[model samples]
Target: MAGTSEMIDLKSTPHSLVENFNLMKGLLATYGPDELQVLREKAFRNFTEFGIPTTKDEEFKYLSLRALEDGRFAPAYGATIDRFELEQSVLGPIDAINVVFINGEYAPELSSAHALPKGVFIGSLKDGFTVYEEVILEHLGKIANLTGKLGSTNDERFVYLNTAYLTDGAFVYLPKGVSLEQPIHLIYLSKADHGPLVSYPRTLIVLGENSDAKLLESYLGMDGVYFTNAVTEVVMGESAILEHTKFQQEKLESVHIAATSIHQSEDSIYTNNNINFGGHIARNDVNVWLDGEHTETWLNGASVGLGHQAIDNHTRIDHAKPNCNSFEVYKAILGDHALGVFNGKIFVYEDAQKTDAKQTNKAILLSPTATINTKPQLEIFADDVKCTHGATIGQLREDSMFYLQSRGIPKDEARGLLVYAFAAEVLEKVTIASAREVLENALFAKLKESQDMPEKGGE
Candidate 1:
């Protein structure tokens, strides 16, 4: 970490900002002139409102950005990456097209396209700006309206900062009538240089009409006090079908804050599975907007919290038209003195007379030191809507554990087996078979790691 003087000087005049703006300004000067101006205005506003987050803010009650105030971090400049580094920083055995982003910049040289299905276009958002500017312009900031959301207060600062200083990330666009069997994977790796640095990864996905595809996105941060502020937006066109999975496994020394927005059109089907496993402070905000009638959406997630880390999942499902349906299930396994928070909100608009929504949040405390806070809510403006929301936090089922033990398994192994079964209900729902195996292995390993951890209450 830098000293007080060094921190002050760095924050006051960040080299990353200077380098990024110059590059972006030059890029925008060539294309997106109008959008560039708008981004500048947004950045100025964000800067005015952002300094550091305190405990009083409800959205940030469990997250503190004070560690970021030291100001030794900057948006990464240049690719400056090695293939070995990419392989070491990521979770492997991946048999799909891999797009790598080092400190938020796309690294095609390090990425591979050998597994991509024919006709699938995967490239950098910056490069796409030159070739697919219209699509990028049409969808950029469409979900993240910097005017009213939770992060909007500092929109000028963070939004503008990201927009003006942004360099690269994955851009996935499935042309109309295209169907991809293999998943397109995007990996965001944050390299901390043994100090306080941040990586802002921006991802955009567009599925055209009658298109079908699956996406696997993951985030992993190396040592040092790293921060991952990522924003992902997905749009599904009418009659399109998409299955998206996101896995976040940053290290314990990292702070991760991510926002995912999904928009579904008429007769479209969208499924999102998010599994969060790491990070000292991990918070994910997911918003689903059902704008078309006869649309179907599912939001499922499982999180594991250990040590003193806090993981929060805030989800919102909005039914804007009639005959839309949504189901949300989030499960958490808490260990040590960790904390898990789940807030699920379902909104049925007046016109959504036949909207159907169900939400459930469940948690299992492995140790007395673990804590879980869950709030499930439903707001129905339409009297004909059918909605249900519930939350449950408890230990493993003793009867199930006893059954396993009676079958000759040891006590601890039996307990673990039952716990795995409890969490498996949601895990089994993961669409990709290969990804499912990887997730299962990771979850079991995490459970084993926390099993030996000292329980605060010693159950």
Candidate 2:
């Protein structure tokens, strides 16, 4: 690391990621400046300066990175995967134009982008560097840089890592006044049939003025003890409307870390729904910056943690201009010894006089051993702004459970029903019918499994 005085030795560090820096640099050498080589160099330098984050870091204070720090995972390069198996993991109906990536590399044979509307570009980031260099160069890594926005922090290091290893993910570009009738699906699956592996999936979306679109970014795994470090950046032009949904369902043995940054222009609207049901250790960072007046932003998230799983959701919504409106609601259901963490911050700058922002986080603990930590904060510098934030952590209400049980429902069934109702609030916010249906089914299935476990005193 450059900022730190001590040099981290790749040979001594457990599961050391620095060992692959040479390989990554070699890969970058193959591309010219037009292909993002310069940006990659800058990001790699930042990663080296910051180094890997530890539990001691405030941003990662609750979650431990030991699994990622100690486990040796080879970079997934040219890993083979079955298309049929990939198809089986689609979240919704298989009719939409889907862009599939296996092991962090774009697989055109498994993707369906042929039916996209005119003036809408959907393809791989690797190709976007060459085909859409101007757009990629303008937006890529601009948000990942943390110097001016959030300041120096360990959480930003992951973005630097993704920028350095940026290979192939999804790229969507909508020109002015274009509207897509069907949603675009970007599917990323990590299948480590070869061995323990690591992959970086990067996505960039640009929507021009008055453009409208819906996009789904899904991360899935097919039986692997691997690591997924993914980053997505979205830029919305004036009067643009984008409904974005992110679903993470990696295997229980894998580790997943993701960062999504969205920038909105004047009078634009951005709605996001994030759902997590898998991954042994998962952390999600979502940030939205409202830079223009009259912009609207909505964020809703739901996570289910069972067994010893650990899931964390961190979000920030910045109201930089006047008359901007933002709302956020995040819910979680934890069972067994699982742990869930939620930290949401809403910021209203001095010039954002008419900003209206609200944030709420709620969690339900199903077992006595299950745990949840939630913090909702609002920083308002604008005098006329309306901002409120709150969080609640508790188990299901005994009276509600008793009422359901008195209505002839079994104890397990009553518990399951309560859990479903609590989680469904966020799932219902998903505007995509197909995606909502899939999430509803997955939520219940998880609740049912939790209900089967032995009773705990928390109930």
Candidate 3:
């Protein structure tokens, strides 16, 4: 342990970020759980091997980590947030099984407490080690391709960083033949009380055969400099179904990065809708694998970037078996010098005959200075598979704007309406009614605030 701690490459690590290494070392040495010691060490070793990601890496070519690396970020603990503030952060009133986390520590008092059905579990990841020992042991590090595990080398460095300090997070499980009528909401709130704060939020979800459930994860933090690095892994049994949504509204001055991995079995279905409204430097990496025949995957997302914020979304779906299908659609709205990026990839294996896959990404830039970078790729080795991918980047159409203005709407309102309709195309796919309402409200509000955007074509 001492050797590995000393081996952490300092050259690649920033001076202020070294405290995190020391913090992880102390936590592991003093009171780390016995069952997870090896996993923690392996994850730390991976971080030691590669401290942080830079633009030099192909995956991070367009995204920059300067703001996150140079800041002094210490893990925030026991943060006391007001009930009113917590309530206001939510986009809408959704009667969900709410689980609240204040600065990465589970807050039972703030969360909704209820007894789930038999063979189902919902609680913090810390207690889950004992409460759901067998399930945790089996699927904890299986998904996300733990870079922490030896002999593995492909992953964004933050995933390993989050794993090394993964003590508390949200965990949910369902046995065969069970279904959850109410969606589970994991709400995270962050405050930089002492100084620039840092928190790692981790999650693991497992679904048994023939079971179905819905999950939503939301993040909203106070106006301060902070970093939220999160990772979530999911596994679906044969014929299982899951509806997943992630709502991120971090303050534009903060740093946020999340990686989500999903594995689906035979006849299973998985759907994801990730919405991003605010963040100084936000990045979402979602990966899915269709490991069984007749499985289906759907991925949709929308991002609104403003005020120099850099928001990036990277997604990949792999068809490994026959008769599998996958679809992805992502949209973005950028203004006031903001930067938005979208990269989607689909891979169809040789054995994945009869596979169908499609991917599309579109972005609307509202200012001459605002920018959008999009790349859609498809790789199909199977001769009988159908695969296609495309991306489009452009400003608002003048014809539509004129039509709306000539009718009765103001220029700003007309622009907002046009942008809203474009983004709502993707958000409308969210299965939860309340969730869709919340998403639509947030999208319009974001669009409304940027009404001063230069006229179409930067008049």
Candidate 4:
């Protein structure tokens, strides 16, 4: 172990995680070959070096891992879930190829049985390495690794943890010039049927040149006290386009941590829409490196927090090449004693003269006790660039509420409609019709659950 816990006290470290990591190593290492085992060992060094991050760590300042440190959560490598239940639970209002994973392990029997495109490949990472070993080797760690450009202090802290304990996850690959008419839905079901559990979900997606695809991923907690630490890596070839949407609908007792790393090639376009509605403690981080010129990126997110839950969104867009354009918009709705945090940073390199980046973060608190902390930042070394960042935090406008109530709407209806409209701005960004429908339902459903919201702070 190279980097041990130097920040937090060793006595207060995440003992359970250390134990689980050691236990899973011997068993899970057999899934992959020796090459991967060597890589896993290398990652373990980074994990021990950084240790589990504490609230004191700037990267994890807003969210605390005290709960995880206090309790012992065994790793879930295999779990049995009902097939019909998976369909009724996660496949709501979507007709697409469904890839189901239970407790981080791929469930092939439950996945879509239809035939895929001639040149496309979709299966478990476990199977991908067997069938497409060359592609897996070339791009897996290239986009996201413990010792590489992608391995920043913020990434090393948790990403290495996932790598050290990783088992099996989804793997998707699309060949050049192939566009699937239907989308791919990845459903992750975390079922702690036995006791408290922790699952680490890993994914790697590679899109070849001039290809296009739409992807949907959802994290669901069937029912139990559990934690999910998930990581996704994307490799986009020149002129490739991908539309990705993520839905976080875990149980309130579940904690969810998600991180995504993307590498864009020239003329590539990547758009992501994140909708967070559940999880007792949910934090999502998305980092995009526009390494190629003429690349366009759009990052949008909407989060709804109620009760004593907490939601945090952190994103970074690195403009490494010139002539790149990136747009980011994030919105949040908090009620009761919940908390929301957003930190978005955009960095432009010296040679990235034609970089045009814009970021906007807005939040609405529906209760006097609800709290929101937001920071939008930009760092530019190029003088001939257009970069702007702004954040707004406030409650519902009285004038707008009055306008709605004076017409035909009641107070509760008016308030709900206002909140709905506020969130719809980002929800409308979902391009897939079925996925948008699912998000719309979750948007209004979460807002309704936040009813009886203690009056908006000032009145």
Candidate 5:
């Protein structure tokens, strides 16, 4: 393996370099013959052609994939963990059916399966892929095509790396007319006794026609600093409704990159909520495609960064058909030299008439050294469409702060109240009241860090 300086050759694409290509090949060599053949024949071509993306690429400009070039991480160890111990360590207080991954290995003992109603299938994709390989082949790798779109770096390499060493992740299937009463929880945890640990977790959720469900995916880490690269693909059938939330709560020393893609059919409703709170460097790519008419989609996110942490979110919502609707709102709170990046793109096709799309991104920098870069883009080809996008970057409203202070509330309390109100827009959308309260309390705990400052010379 080559070091960071020699991994990505500036003059040439990553895959063209002998070391990068060989490393890619060596990574595949560990997998089964069938898996190796599948990746090499199906996805490896994309990596070979484009190499990895650099800062010159507009979409990946903010995210530094260079970390992967460092060759400092190794695949996580597969260890046997007690079911009760794993559950206690990871799930915390979330209320849902649990699917746990320990050290990148699936722990069946820690998972619970309530008899899913008719038209619902929830389990490991690897199991389904092994037992129902034909079904898996139909939808896998359908969204992120191999063709070099954003300067030749598709997620295929990382995804292929995942496939090469994947132990297991959840696979959810909702049949036509089915409704899941309880949310499905998928948790990924890494215990980093071995240095240079890397874990790739993948999930695929398929919702049939007229189906409704909610999914919560969470990530947590142990003492050792590790790397987690995850991918989730969602396919929503006609008139299907899906409320999906992905929460990242790794340790401060961790590095994580995740990609979430949703494909919607006609009249389908898909809502995606992403929350990020930890990681040394974190990046998320969220993409939703409206393939059929009358589709409705919502993209909402909240992220808080402290210390030297960095969070980057790149999202794309494509209006491919007619009469589709989409709304997006993203909020970020940065402090103590943390960095936040928000890049969102909305594309309306030529035939996407009567499309209604709106997007807004707001950021609050609690520290002067904190930074945020926000960009929202719209490409519309239809004339009969309602599209709007706007972004704002600043600190909390001082006037609101002053108003609260004047009402006899202390300045710290006033700031927390105003900041909580600003974030309430997204928090209110939490479907489960219990889940909402948990997240709300977590936000408060984080905000308290800003409030609990020492008085200057006893005030």
Candidate 6:
């Protein structure tokens, strides 16, 4: 454990950040060999140079990190929680294999990975390095390299932080021509009773050529004011098909920042469903690189914020090769004084002829104080590419409420029904039936809570 020095000025440099850096250096011996040590040093330097992003940064212009910085959270290295307590906080059902992590450390007893397929490997990153050393070394930091041009200054800093503090997370590898019958569920739980803490969880998924698999990553906080900085890197081999889903439901007082990067090969299919329901301040970045021809990608996301919560969703899809296709839809529902932000970008390189990309972001404000900022952008250098992006921000339609009310539905029920319908458009796109059911029920409950409050502009 690391302690912050009170004599240090917090204004010039965040004391907590500095303390965590020192803690990481001290724990470097536990990470791995000299090779990983060098990589860690490089990542630390990147974090120091980029620093924390401020309001002036273009990518984070709509959101601020002051709340997180002021918290001065140190890294949670030796934190521990009971297995029963951790199991109770899991998001999905207990049927799937659950790779559980508590306070950034892998808990094998809480995890169930004994029955995986013959060739499929699902385990912790720290263990993966020892068992699949060659593979892990080859692809561990490759995505970070590819993301050099994808993130803002703040994003880069977080990426570096994640790399420097990278300890334990889920790692899955599917061999060529194999299909996983059951989805691999990765569950991350944060429990920080001692003090304000932070945890960095990393995940790596690789699908071999012609392989098929599904993955679910869920983040939950049992209690306390903490921060969870997580990063997931996925590589899809030629003709690989993968369905990925993420659900984030941290404690309301916690700050959650996550980044997911995907690299698609030729003829590969990648689908992602990201759902955020908790956290005082939550930000998610999803980036996909279509590095091969004939790649197909689908992205669907939904965020629900209440009280003083702030949720931001950012996504980017790069059609680097020709004949690639992508579709994205993100929706947000905010109530009380909550704020929501959505930014989606599509980039089609000059060589990506016949590329087709489409993005849509819709936001609903349930209260007068609730705010939303959405930006959808498309940059296409290829003349033959079909790229389109659009954003919509509005309140629940009174007409729709009236129409539903005319059907004998109560006013509150009508509003809840309409809100649920709006959010279901993206939730229904989630292919995992179990995960979708949980999310649908959660959204309905959130909508009902929002409906209990008086209309923002009405009596």
Best by lDDT: 4
Give residue 78's lDDT in candidate 2 (0 to 100).
69
Candidates 1 and 2 compared by lDDT, better number: 2
What's the TM-score of each model vs. the native? 0.87, 0.92, 0.92, 0.94, 0.87, 0.92
Off by over 4 Å in 3: 1-18, 28-33, 146-154, 451-459
Q: Write candidate 5's Cα lDDT for 238-295 as tens digits.
A: 9999988887878888888788888899999999888888788888889888889989
* Model 1: lDDT of residue 426: 72
Q: Candidates' lDDT values, in order?
A: 0.74, 0.81, 0.81, 0.82, 0.73, 0.80
Candidate 2 lDDT over 256-371, as tens digits, reads 99999999999999999999998999999999988899999999999999998999998988788899999999999898999899988787788889899989899888788998
- Scanning candidate 5 in windows of ten residues, the lowest lDDT window is 450-459
lDDT of 1 at 134: 85
Candidate 1 lDDT, 1-459, residue by residue in tens:
111221223334555433445545656455443775676556544543343345444545555555555545655544465777655543655667788887777778878866455545687887777767888779877865434422211212234455544446778888788888777888887777655667778888999998998888988765556778788889899999988889898888788878888889999999888888889888888888887999999999899888888898878887888999898889998888998888787878788998989898999898888888887767778899889888888877778767877888777767677666666677787777877877787777677678543221212
Cα miss at 120, model 5 (Å)? 2.2
Q: What's the CA RMSD for each of the models? A: 5.3, 3.3, 4.2, 3.3, 4.6, 4.5
Superposed Cα deviation of residue 335, candidate 3 (Å): 0.6
Model 3, 72: alpha-carbon shift in Å? 0.8
Candidate 6 lDDT, 1-459, residue by residue in tens: 011121223346656775677766867646765677777788877666666676566667777888766757877856676766764553545457778888888988788747766667898888777778778778887875544453332255677778877667788888899888787788888888888899999999989999998788889888898999999999999999998889898999998988899999999999999989989989998989899999999999989999988999988888889999999989898989999998887878889999988888898888889999888777777899888878888868889989988988788767766777888888887777787777786666565556444332221
The predicted structure with the larger lDDT, 2 or 4, is 4
Q: Which ten-residue region of model 4 has the weakest summed lDDT?
A: 145-154
> Which clashing pairs does model 1 show?
43-160, 45-156, 46-156, 46-157, 47-156, 47-157
Put the candidates in lDDT order, highest first: 4, 2, 3, 6, 1, 5
- Candidate number that wins on lDDT, 3 or 5: 3
Q: What is the lDDT of candidate 2?
A: 0.81
